[model samples]
Target: MKAMKRSTLATLINATLFSAVAGTSFSTLAEEAQAKSNQLEVIQITARKRVENAQEVPVSVSALQGDNLDAYSSAGMDIRFMNAKIPSLSVESSFGRTFPRFYVRGLGNTDFDLNASQPVSLVVDEVVQENPILKGFPVFDIARIEVLRGPQGTLFGRNTPAGLVKFDSVKPSQEFDGYAAVSYGSNSSIDFEGAAGTGLTDKISTRVSVLVQDKPDYIDVKAPGFEKEDSLGGYNEMAARVQFLYEGDDFTGLLNYHVRDLDGRPIAFRANLIEKGSNNINPLYDNDVVYHDAASRSTQEVDTQGLSLKLEWDLKEHTITSISGWESAEIYSRADVDGGYGNDFAPTMGPGFIPFSSETADAIPEHDQYTQELRLSSNFTGDFNYQVGLFLFEEDLTIESYSFDTGTYDEAAGNYGLQNGYAVQEQETSAWALFGSFDYSVSEQLDVTLGLRYSDDEKDFYAKRTDNPTPWNGSPDFLEGRANPSDSHVSWDLSATYKLTDDVNLFGRLANGFRAPSVQGRILFGDVVTVAESETTNSIEFGVKSDVLDGQGRVNATVFYFQMDDQQLTAVGGGSNFNRLINADKTTGYGFELDTEWVLTDELNATFNLSYNKTELEDDTLAVAVCAQCTVTDPTYTIQGPNGPEARAILDGNSLPHAPEWISNATLRYTKELEGGEFFVYTDLSYRSEIDFFLYESIEFKGEALFEAGVRAGYAWNSGDNDYEVSAFVRNLFDEQVVIGGVDFNNNTGMLNEERFVGAEFKVKFF
Candidate 1:
């Protein structure tokens, strides 16, 4: 009865997708898998712009899909589901499910601004989602997710020095198909998602997919002097996608459109969650309760739409392809920045020194992004093949930032509980790139490939501050500030693969990539716009891939070293309400990764992944401002800051912020034949070492190691080539809770990881 009641909404939503059930593009993906004489299936990837065996690819790549992907995203989880699942990869976000920040090989950006640039990029259906907002598109009906590690600039364009994540959706097919999935979990979490597709005609096919997620606020908020409305830990999000494919004698075209709507809360910055002198959580930190005094705070909303078209023409021995895309989004979010109400000015302030009350709102009123690419590839059955492409991109964005008073109210002067400061920033960006990849097979055991890309990037940026904080003394207003940054660079990579045996391969790769110049115009608190110059990286890696124990086990290992010149860095939240862009003279990183999979028995399987990364700045004269409260571990010296002589930490050899030293993951699956079906159990675990939240080393800002585990069990059976499944899942099995990020500008504020959740899921697919 409970299952039926929980699945009712999903049934209705799926019915809206059409009269068909939900899945199959993933199960029947490869026409020719080339599997060995074993139970394990062959893995396929598009790491080098071509579908090939994973072992044959020279670059380090990992893929997650099928039931595994479903298990992680059972309870309306966002894209952060990929965190710590693969070697050398981490995902975190301060904006909840809106903008996920990805780090590959310990290289990433930590700026929380709307216009921040990332070292890692995201590509959906071969079109780059360059903007941070677009990168959070709901994950549904995705056929496969590939993570290409290391420098991918030669083929993926700029802002890819760390790597890139690619998501490929299931395209329209001639046969009629559909699937529906639903899960009801703790926190009143409901995940309803499904897809439907069918052939309208012999030459035309279409597919539609939709997703809906909702959760109620479960935390209690106690405000002593004010009325509190919406609590934290709740959200309602919906997304839809539609695609049409047209196939001709020698041509094919595909058009896609998608939209997203989300209503959620901002990150709850727990004031003084971390102790002033230690890394551990303070005694006042409570997972299920909050002590916010701010009235009517915490509101967030986001809306986005995108459309793309792809066309391809097949010549006798060559192919030409074109892709065009456009995207736009708007968002408004307001939150109590200090995590509480009543500043030090009031005698009732608790939770540490309270400092001062800080409340702010950020909005993106206008945003537009356009991209186009043209490519030509050779399909000759010879030793040599090549692919070349030309890409163009443009974007225009506007940001509105406001500060509000959270203390006493003065209706006449609008002092407290009203708007205090306001600022607006606008930016326009244009970029173009020409990229090519060439491959040659010298023999049956040796293959070599080369890639090159030339990119020209530029940005036009301006910011203005119109209002100053009236509740307290603030920086003077500034206007008419302009910053135009531009640059051009050529990225290249060379790789080779040597077949050591029928089931083993050794590969080596050398690549150089660069992130384009970025401008920071977040002048809501600061008076000037800062720009970080182009940062480039040169990396080399060697690896071995092998299928052992009669193809029942697989192991892949890699060792890499890299050095970067003029590395871009962002100093955020160090007793300041601004993000400062800086460039390190030199930086270096080295790492090793190992991935292993084994079929212990016909009824059991296991997989493990591990990575160790060490990154450091090499400059001798690099220093940054230090936090006001934390116990500094680095040597501090006074420097002339915006105020006066301020303490600066010597960060010449400090590891990158949020870059963990070790990460590991493991999974185990067991199955047993049941009456007319199969009963299976799956469990997964991930762990990451401690990390510093800023350039300077401090005790309070360091995030301790975290380990999380999950389990899912279910029974599944087939009906006339169709599939049906019902499962019960538990995430964060141990109820692990730890701080994931920090707000250093204010007290010992900290953000936490996801909470424990339990749910039931059911899925139906028909063909």
Candidate 2:
């Protein structure tokens, strides 16, 4: 009888998975998961926007809901696939899947400037996706994905001093239902998603979501007179969302709209890609082959849109909230910044050394963002509770850059149209905030939290430089520079939460964060427009949030430290394709993080995360430039460059460019229910260690220690109103290709990672 019901459902799933991990306890999100009975459920988090129960949330959060966010984007991932998947998080980008670039703990801001200014910070649903092409929005119908870490600037404001990433989606509840999925991988890659929700009355409700991914042109390129189409890698992405909900009694409303599109392929970087001074990856690397030669044919395009509105009211014990948002984006990227082909005074060149033939372009054309938030809270549950807020922000940006002239090439044909160079940058930002949070219970096992914020920031910047292929250094330089930086800061956070038993909870936190005053202008190759002055961070944390074995495992650990004043730093591309903005008199970091969850039975469950950070940069009269050919370990000094001298490099303590002092990730899942439904396997792994792709230090730019893995297998059932699944997957499961980011002015270029994705998936649901 079907092999005796698969051996009696694997012996009743190993006796209910270790008797449900010795009698159950676990969970967190699918809307803050709260299951019971079948056990292992009851973990919720909002990291202080209240939804509590993450062992009482004293902040240092970590969350990624259900099926680990559907197996991390299910191949066809983006948002740098959330590099290192949380725990001192990290995500990088050279404009590949749009503009990722996020880092926490070790801070971040590697200036790929499209108005770059980051220290993490990206919130969705609660708005705040301040640029970076609207933070590459795409990650559909999510229900949770926290990762709060450090210095969240009181309730998230400004460019959070290295922290905050929150996304919450899936709302609209009279509950009708939804689901649809598709996946197909390996070079022809395809991924699709769908969602739906309903409720037409009884106070209205609605939801809709969609995503699509595509891949083609399958790599393999060589340009010689470029007829364009060696196909430099490929992608096509689309996104959509629409939501509405209205529930009234005391009142509530929510509306959201979203859109995105991308036609990719612009980060194939790989010229001598390391290995001359070794950072590996260059035995003539090939993942289908590449040689971005005579560039320009490699392109990227993006478009984005957003709109949001949230409202709530209930004045019996106090409750009111409002959020409004609008965002728009346009982006264009064209690469092949010297990853080989024509140079050495061109006629032709090799994949080996293409010393001069960077053809780049970056654009935003125009963009806008606006936000407003207002809040008031305290809805019963005494012992003093409070929350107050007001926030507003605006941004208008425009950035453009172009350069071409792959050096009069004719080595057979590829004649890159001479656009020489062009530049323009404009920024306008205004910000305001006033926030408050308070909670006190004093006894009953202690509880305290205080948060305050008062921010005011402004920026008006300008930079211009039209055409300059070195025509006597100045072709057009209308303005060259301008910045009107303004700042006002007051960030705070104080926390305490001791319940020490009853499933433990012990916490302590002290925080202050800021970042607002930064402007960099790459006037198509320098002309002064660099400013970095506002930076501040002060942090301290301690933690323990347990449930441990007795409750079927769950451990959250923390230990943190921070200090930053000035900080900010960007200084990219030493041989010069410029991006300079520096400020660092001090910068520091210390970390420890661990989040664990285990049910390990009753069909298995496991999650593990680890982090250890250490970021320095103590500035000893800070220096900049460096890398006129690898190997330069600190103390250098030269500076003259407009075409002369320029070696710089002092940066006192170092450590911060892409910071990676060990990070870890793990996941394991197993299930079996046989007869007519359930059978699963899941695997995931991530690791990071070495990193240092700029700001001094060398050995070919640095970036090595790495590991990645992914796997999935499945069978799920419930038919009638439907619910089905069938899967097979693998994503870079040991096809390891490493070498991430490096292009210190060309030769030895770099960038890789993402190849090896085999897939199969099908899902349907309507329950």
Q: Highest lDDT among the candidates is held by which one?
A: 1
Using Cα atoms with residue i matched to residue i, what is each candidate's TM-score against the true structure?
0.93, 0.35
Best by TM-score: 1
* Model 1 Cα shift for residue 61 (angstroms): 0.5
Write down the TM-score for model 2: 0.35
The 0-to-1 C-alpha lDDT of every candidate, in the order given, reads 0.84, 0.80
Give per-residue lDDT, candidate 2, residue 301. Answer: 87
lDDT of 1 by residue, 324-383 (tens): 999998999888777765668887875777888888888999999999999999998999
User: Model 1 compared with the native: what TM-score?
Assistant: 0.93
Error of 1 at 408 (Å): 4.6
Hey, what RMSD does candidate 2 come out at? 24.1
Candidate 1, clashing residue pairs? 21-178, 21-179, 22-178, 22-179, 22-180, 23-179
